[model samples]
Target: MLLQGGAFSACNLAIIENRRLPGWICNAAPSGRLGRAHSSRVMSVATGEQMSKPHAPTHQPSLANRLRLGSLADDGLSYKEKFIVRCYEVGINKTATVETIANLLQEIGCNHAQSVGFSTDGFATTLSMRQLHLIWVTARMHIEIYKYPAWSDVIEIETWCQSEGRIGTRRDWILKNYANGEVIGRATSKWVMMNQDTRRLQKVTDDVRDEVLFYCPKELRLAFPEKNNASLKKIAKLDEAAAYSRAGLVPRRSDLDMNQHVNNVAYIGWVLESMPQEIIDSHELQTITLDYKRECQHDDIVDSLTSPESAMTESVSELQGSNGSPTSANSENDCLQFLHLLRLSSDGSEINRCRTEWRKKPAKR
Candidate 1:
């Protein structure tokens, strides 16, 4: 779903509050697909306090956008660098709603994977994977949850831009369980303007105007932005992440495939090295979504990130071990791993953008 441009603010430090519910931002009711079993449902969540009343369901809004990741980060939740994964009855739950968090992910992280619509809301609302330069700012926005319990209602959702760069912009957000703080989900995403015709990254000659769209729009000409070597690492802004534990591993020739780039799935094995051995052995992955931005090569000095936000961003997950450890909770180094926007000097060219995210389902010990 898309949102409109509202406000923005950058996050300085990660937040670590014992919040039961995430803060509320706006209200949106999604319209289901045609010929579906059920379309839309008016939801009353045991979540949090409801603020303003719905103006009127004049017309089902288009995919919503127009939000900066900074505003989401500026708030105390600070998911741009961290996120919460609550161990619930069925599965872990994050407090943030899908729309708000999705918007933020578009702004803050490197979303090279096109949003290809989720299975849960395939009908009326679903995020489809599209090229970065092809994305557009959502003109209107609203979210409706047809299924519950299985689908945590986005009790409250908000968006923000964590950072803005010479060529690309970063967004972040939070999804809270209105039913209190039973769950909260946060995310970060990034976008680069492109020449609509060529589907190539382009420089922004005009101000965001005349229908600044998200899923590929038309532009005059192709102009590349001045690339830089800056990394958009905002780890210090999250509260739910633990101190990172580094590990060293030797790459096997099998890890090196054609293209000489490290095979994508090989990174998960790298992350597993840093996680608790027990969880690695016991947990069965229930839902795994890997977003591969940059490829890895054999024998490179790679840092295997098993952190939650890293796992979520990269799609390589480790099980729940540290959350139970006070040491884990207490260790807040404010060190963010630089993932995206690695620039090379000389001509200021882009090497590549690399990041990962994952979620693990633990086998009952």
Candidate 2:
């Protein structure tokens, strides 16, 4: 489904086509290939809200069309695919928030993996690797935004996976304006598989490695840093006078993903909630870096803490080894910056840390 831009007309086709999917294209949706046989049944959800409308028919595109839609750069070499999506009313910010973009990136990433037959269910069924109790988790995410699409804007996201390592897999994305083909932004994320039953980290097995490597082009020009050193080793320390804190924010069922853990995208909103209203009203997020240290479950009570750049006085060297450096220190910039922390309210266990930079709203054209 290719949605062009203007207004709701640009979104109509995309919405109609997406409704044909047997299940939601969200991280919380069931894994594996969705078939027409299951399209009519009501979805049984664990934590999130159910759709008010009926289930939509699923569309499985032909192989040729899939390649064309993704605008495959080189046949037989790249597995990059395109996902055409619409920005919905709920995802729109006063200026089409950065959190919304993060959500879209997450969706396309899952879809790309599913298209290549790398789903959680597939690991058990196709590969017969059920004994591992596998679940995929994002280790780190870094997004740089050049522009934020507003409600009704049609976006075409092209994504692909990089080769998998024994412990990590890399995925990259490019967001484009559907109407004129303008570049929107790009993001890259690192992921690792874990054992669901044992709650222990699992290495990428040989079978999994061989399958993902088949699609990964060793020479692909897209690049992400090897270590994420800056985003990972930076820590945010908040004092009473300089920080604003929101306590006892619990994760709802809706925040849980297919893995039954709080979705990483949900953290963006929780962290933003602690920022001063004035900054949210006057500025827009330009870039964000998040390092996931631990998972938050539905029963966990989370706390979000935020402090402006003015309040963050520590240097990067000071945070090298502290708390494993979940985040980075703030620096002066034309755009405003905020240091954020999301922790368990009970024992103050750090869930994840974030750093965000916001740009002033541009003057009306």
Candidate 3:
């Protein structure tokens, strides 16, 4: 017998004995695949005989399952996950934007915390932290990008955290192209606890330290070793007159995260807002180090100020010693560096200080 819409064909009709009345129950299959039965159903009859209801449809995985969620690495100390670069994540250059990369790093870090049972609330806060109204705040971040993945490219990220000191912890990440297994980027960040209500920094308590250290590895493993500390050195404050400035920059509603503060990634965008267009077009960001000084709210008006390190003669000479020759001092291979400052427009209080290194873009063939 054919079912509704003639899509399913019923077969193997069986007689069932019922106290009320007799009814027919049969297995149904798609009309095209009649030999392969998929579901079972009972026909409705005039007399009340226990009607066999249709079995529930087979469970199927959702589209979100396509995304490879974070899981512990084989060594059991680090967390790793694969992400497909979505169309929206890419910029006009057809590669993932710096902000997108930063967001991914943040996501994997949070996921690592949650996997270790440290994040009871959404913000990677412990149960004690929630009770004490404490939250983690980033103090410093340094990121280096060798390559950026284009849209639809699959990239794998591995991240781990370790105790920095009595009051702080550090997290590091390594990003790679999943297709060719090429290392593309690495990032490290320092975070400290803060009192959510008082808006002041807090030291890591003994309870929190023990809980976090339990998951950290015994041996220290750094993506950026100590020898590379030159690139991760402290970013000097941009004290000179700003060469470029973008004032009245307001945070969009979307910029605020679950913590009710402008996210770190948004600050990255604001820092770039004041960058000279010629630099943006001619160079690609190689390294960026951000020292977050204060948090910004949605209503806070901001001014993004930038100054090229080359303009500071003494600083440039110190960075790249001059050999009494102009050509050697300003070689093409020499990276262009910039200092960026983001401050509140109202009182000029500093929000973030950034140092960026850029390399000349390769000429198109």
Candidate 4:
């Protein structure tokens, strides 16, 4: 039976269709895999519609029907999916949160890998990688949001991956307002392989390279082009002498992902834990760049440190110079920028370093 606003179990898989009434049709099959199951129910939480009759157990959705949920774009190199921003995914501002946006990016990236016949054992790993006990680890990520979608808003996300030299791969995404096709945000990330057992960085093997390259686009296309790529610059490392710090931050059991480590999105929340209340209240995150250093376990204690970019002039002057100085285009367009760091409390080893830029919220009319 359909349950309004109810969470799907891990064993159930839900495929969303954008129709007159957008809704999820969940199949209560084992491990969330699609199979010959007649116990499926339509979940239309947006309009509170009644459950539809169960499909015949012997019948299966056509490939075209399945692709409607999420499919490779016309380019054949990128994958696109639509998601309705659920109430739980929004914040007090009645808009989607940064964590929610990051989660959607991760979801689309995984779906793109799956669409191209990659091994499902882990995040975008190939069958050869699984045999070698290898996994992908994020190296860097940069995201910029022009606008945040509100609750119930349907947003379309497209993502594609390309080779980043012999040691890493790069993935880029474009997020759009599905109703009007307005670009809402764009993000790019870099990832490298690692040995699951030894935790050492691994080079991309010829087998693995050939497997993924076959699906990549022949010509290079980036979400953020390099000509006007201010966001592509390297993020400066925040020092230990940050003015604000919150220690003893622990990851909750729910914070871990399939890799049995703290999810990358969780680190964003932890980084914000030490942010000044004034900034959090008066401004909204506009751009953020994260450089992951090492993984954090569930038991590892973390410390979040933050400092205003103005305070780190000595260390970041070169970066600011390269990006060009901020100008007074509009007095109301002023922004607040900060450098952040998340480190283990045990030996003070770095976990991640970040830079965040925020814009003042428009005054309520």
Evaluate all candidate structures by whole-model CA lDDT and list the values in order: 0.28, 0.56, 0.66, 0.68
In candidate 1, stretches whose alpha carbon ends up further than 4 angstroms from where it belongs are 1-155, 160-166, 181-183, 209-365
Off by over 4 Å in 3: 1-67, 120-122, 310-334, 363-365
RMSD of 4: 11.7
Off by over 4 Å in 2: 1-87, 90-95, 120-129, 223-242, 310-333
Lowest summed-lDDT stretch of 10 residues in model 2? 1-10
Score every model by TM-score: 0.31, 0.68, 0.75, 0.76
Q: Write the per-residue lDDT of candidate 1 for residues 57-160, one digit (tens) a residue.
A: 22222233122112122212122222232224133332222322333333332211111111111111111212222332211111111112233342344443
Across 173-230, the per-residue lDDT of candidate 4 in tens digits comes to: 8888899877788888888887889978899998778656655777887777645464
Displacement of residue 310 (Cα, Å) in model 3 is 4.1
lDDT tens digits, residues 1-365, model 2?
00000111112224323322223221112322332212223233321445555434234443442344442233222234444444443332533567667776765554444433333342211132344566667777877666666656677776667755797577776666677776666676777777777657778888767645654666653533334423344656544453788888988888886667888888888888798888867776766878788888889998899887664322323213211221222345447877888888899888887887777765542
lDDT of 3 by residue, 286-361 (tens): 6798999989999999999999875522212211211111111234455788899999999999999999877775
Question: lDDT for model 3, on a 0 to 1 scale?
Answer: 0.66
Clashing pairs in 2: 20-57, 47-253, 234-327, 234-328, 235-327
Report how far residue 268 has shifted in candidate 3, in Å.
0.4
Q: Give the TM-score of candidate 2.
A: 0.68
Candidate achieving the largest lDDT: 4
> Which scores higher on lDDT, 2 or 3?
3
Q: Per-residue lDDT for 94 in model 4?
A: 87
